[model samples]
Target: MDRSPPVIVFPPESGGGRRVTIRGEAVGTAHGLFDVLELLHSAGLPAVDTAVDDPELIEWRGGGPYDWNDGEADER
Candidate 1:
């Protein structure tokens, strides 16, 4: 059997608020470490606060957190 996780497409936030999107199999819903500020920026929302996560996942090519921006560092 092929058991794989769903690809969650995080849509850009709207209204300059923190929005979290999740997509996957039968898994528990838990909030991961995400930057509300970045989410707002990506969603073209107003940049007011500087949100950050402890050891965030980098969205690099080939899956997993590999890309680093600004002062964010890569875990893998």
Candidate 2:
């Protein structure tokens, strides 16, 4: 199974929030990384940290936590 932050879909009207649809299943609604884990845990799945901290899954670690939004348009 692909463990690279399972591609999720945020459909409209999902209980008034962005329902996290992972692997075609609507686990729950989340808006951040921490919430992602909560959703997974609720589904009986391991948290993202478990995957990121696992040495064997280094390839999917995303190569360190670097600047995610450094370059961006100055919207004033």
Candidate 3:
């Protein structure tokens, strides 16, 4: 699937101004990252690095949040 360009998902039963997620990972609530998002939006960019080696960006097709589930897990 095309995971690029990032996807921002809002919380359930909430309005646009709520918890946000990028690729299934929580970045911040809408009220939290408002300024950062605005800057990126104005620049025509899609996302921020979020962290120095984003854990969410690491591909995982496993069962749950456990990263070291097994040695055969597929990770990018």
Which of the numbered candidates is closest to the native, going by highest lDDT?
2
TM-score of each: 0.23, 0.40, 0.30
Question: Candidate 3 at 31: error in angstroms?
Answer: 2.9
Clash number for each model: 1, 0, 0
What are the per-residue Cα lDDT tens digits for candidate 3 across 13-76?
A: 2242344445465655433344335534554554464521244432222222222223222242
Candidate 2's displacement at residue 38, Å, is 0.4
Q: Compute the lDDT for candidate 1.
A: 0.30
How much is the lDDT of residue 37 in candidate 3?
Answer: 54
* Top TM-score prediction, candidate number: 2
Assess candidate 1 and give its TM-score to the true structure.
0.23
Ranking by lDDT: 2, 3, 1
Q: Give per-residue CA lDDT, model 2, range 2-66, as digits (tens).
A: 45545352432323334565556667754344665676677666667664344342221222222
lDDT of each: 0.30, 0.44, 0.37
The regions of model 1 sitting more than 4 angstroms off are 1-34, 50-76
> Model 3, stretches more than 4 Å misplaced?
1-5, 11-16, 36-76
